[model samples]
Target: MERDALLQVANFSTLFACMVLKFPQILVLMRARSTAGVSLNSLVLELAGFIVFVSYQMYYDYPPPTYLEYPILIAQDVILLLLILHYNGNMKQSIFYAAVFIGGWKLLTVEKRVIDLAMSLCTFISASSKLAQLQCLWATKDSSRVSALSWGLATYTCLARIYTTVVMTGDVQVLVRFVAMTILNFWVTATAMYYKPSAKKKD
Candidate 1:
């Protein structure tokens, strides 16, 4: 197959992986009902990053079919956040968090170049999410609360995107974000594997 065809395959295949992969974290959170080792800061930063990323995609008029994934990502993460709050018995605080995220996303509108700025900010913040998780692991040396499946799939998907960017688009502008994200995801995955929680913590 041509490079373009292969790139398309890699692109959609990575999308499919992301679409199916995110729920594992939520599921793990639900079963555990505790955010002990889980980094709420990481989730908040990730949601912020997703908001900007989605806005940037919209600015470029990303294809409707594939672009739908961004909103889906936002929705699922919102649900996950709500679930975490509920389990922590902070229902009122949950509402506040929701309000903040919703208001922030609504206020993201500006000029075209502003969208580019947001996208760059989003990429940096998204990578920071991984750093937050890494710190949590480093401080506690417990990967118990982290979801391996979720991080694993995310790392794999991001790597696939980097490959597609290199072989297909050859667009440095597009490749930069994915490359950065892949590095962070790989780091998180490595830490997750290196630190093993006790049996009770794993619950």
Candidate 2:
């Protein structure tokens, strides 16, 4: 019983750390008042992944394994998604797309196996989009426009995920996902460093 309690505590701690890292992104976005350099595609895909994850948790009646992680993730994604859509002047389309996608998932009442598969696919898509966005930033040499605080938070979150995966072995697929995310996080950090953005040019 003691061992199980300790394990649970450790797991919760790690998950909390990951969520904490991501929480600041919301503040950063609000302060910047611009999602200019952030990738809308990445945010969209990430929102998809989070929706799938939350659905799976609800379907399984699983005590949300990560405590506050999912809630904060969903909140941040929603805010960021809205900001991106508003900035891009696609608010209506974005709202429609989100409603359709989430509604479809709910209507399907997908099985656990199917949910797992779909969630994995969404994770990959989201990660790929983030990588592409980072590549775009590098290509454009406009890292300055990106939020440094958000990037730092992402790096920390990825590291926390890695640690959590290493500590838990119940799900091989999840471990693999975290490994991929960690690698991608490192690449993003490197790009951010190498392509540090300059100050905004005078109007």
User: lDDT of candidate 2 vs native?
Assistant: 0.64
Once superposed on the true structure, which residue ranges of model 1 sit more than 4 Å away at CA?
64-68, 165-173, 198-203
In angstroms, the error of model 2 at 182 is 1.3
RMSD in order of candidates: 3.3, 4.1
Query: TM per model?
Result: 0.86, 0.76
Quick one: best TM-score, which candidate? Answer: 1
Candidate 2: list runs displaced more than 4 Å: 1-24, 57-63, 165-169, 198-203
Best by lDDT: 1
Cα deviation of 39 in candidate 2 (Å)?
Answer: 1.0
lDDT of residue 124 for candidate 1: 82
